[model samples]
Target: MGKLREVEILLNQTQKVRFERAMERLQSLSSTTNNSVIVADSIPFNHDEAFLKGHGTSLVDGELLTTVCGVVNHVDKLVYVRTLRARYKPEVGDIVLLRYSFVAQRQSRWRVDLNSTQDGLLKLSSMNMPDAVQKRNTSVDELNMRNILAEDDVVCAQVGESQRDGSLLARSNKYGKLHKGQLLKVDPYLVRRSNLHFHFIESLGIDLILVRNGFIWVGEHTQSNDPMVVDDEIISSKTRQSILRIGNAIRVLSTLGFTLTLAVIMETFDLSNMENVQIHDMLGSEFHVWSQRGKLKEEHVHSKKNVKALI
Candidate 1:
């Protein structure tokens, strides 16, 4: 309460009223689920009943309990907790955005941060080398290893089979270092897995990568990076604004606990343009109050339709 006051002015009377009502409506629509629980809470399931414990659950003195803070969810006999806010736990084949940690000199593997419990070991032999890095020679020397993946470079890769050494693979041709982008971190739960991760907004000239770990990348759309060409692509002001606009929309949506999909993101981006809101003003309290009313209503309806689908 004290901290929020220092950041900005509170909402005015009318905006406050509207915002409160919208919050009520939003909560009411989602109130059906009573399974959200926290750590050390005893689940109200019969101890005698045959039940299989899954992730986020533990047996404490023969009593089933949650080991983490998340919602309790079950699929038939298998019960697990769906974490709302937690450090990323990498799964098999998950497309994750990574930050370069360092190159392991002796092991000949690049260590990358996955926002997980352990840093992933990426073997030099496993990944298809990026075009941007000109190898000094075939040997994995310290100088050339730095040239391949410099310190603090952002990378996009896939989680491989969890090895004894926690090896992460980047075998796909498309998986490589990401450039010309803005990375936005949000709650991992808000981002659902999509059929395709890379998308191009033809109208805005922006490429949106929906990473599974909740690091959304919005950048200028480019098919390939040319090693020979100089890295001096000057983006027009309009395209730059489009990138910022889309990036802010993702931030605002995620802040509001809105389910982030490509469709809803475009809607939010388009709404800001339609209303003539400046890029900087998108994060203002007034804009937040104004945007949620209509968007929440639309999402509520869409969720219901999805629930009705038989197939």
Candidate 2:
């Protein structure tokens, strides 16, 4: 939705009306109470019951207030707001796709950037070595740490632990150094937590990783045992094109501020292919508007089915 003024000017009268209607439908689906707030606003709450303050909330002279602009959430007696745009908050066992912004040995651990508030720590002993041995890291291995993961390397790993000092612990195996792929960044809030993040579209020969930190990686499919192994052979043109098409579809969905899920992403890709929209054309303003219209139509059909079942 960023910088869409230019795109809006390109729309004709009918398209504009359709776009507005689709957006209105989307808004209607969202919880009005959940999403209506800004920073410094007093959150409406029951005064009779004792409430525990959580993240994005502050107490000011007995009044509960929000510290960030986002949707309000409550769990039992606890209340908090989930921020729409903020740095990634790592959780234990959450898979993350990260680019090594900088890597240096500090106190015998490798500190790497993960696009979070602080760099994550990857202790030498915690990583899966090339030999796949389980032993303490020797001084020689410490000297050769660069051979494992050098600077600026894009990698995937699971969040092991979060330290009291705010640093994160990263552990890796097949989710290590990435290659033969494209990395995309999106808002962390858009990606919903799920049991499975790694997906292989066998028909397209594409691997899609939806990292919890909002880093998405699309690459050629590889065996799970050796995910980081880079094949010297060239990727097929069809596979590359499919990957690009899927990635662009994801981009368009994210731009529309839609909640990103595997189902929605696949549907978008299928819609584009069914419409014979080229990969490049999928990024155009017209295609975006069309995609929204398509989504609205799909939702309308689904709602009608529900109504039929109810009757």
Q: If scored against the real structure, what TM-score would every candidate get?
A: 0.71, 0.71
lDDT, candidate 2, 183-252, per-residue tens = 8888886787787787767667777888778889888877656544556888889888888998998898
**Per-model root-mean-square deviation over C-alphas:** 8.2, 8.1
Q: Please provide, for model 1 over 183-294, each residue's C-alpha lDDT reduced to its tens digit, 9 standing for 90 to 100.
A: 7888776677766787778767788888778778888776664412224688778888989999998887776767677778877887898899999999887777667765
What stretches of model 1 exceed 4 Å from their correct place? 1-35, 38-42, 45-69, 73-82, 105-107, 131-137, 140-142, 225-231, 296-311
Best by TM-score: 2
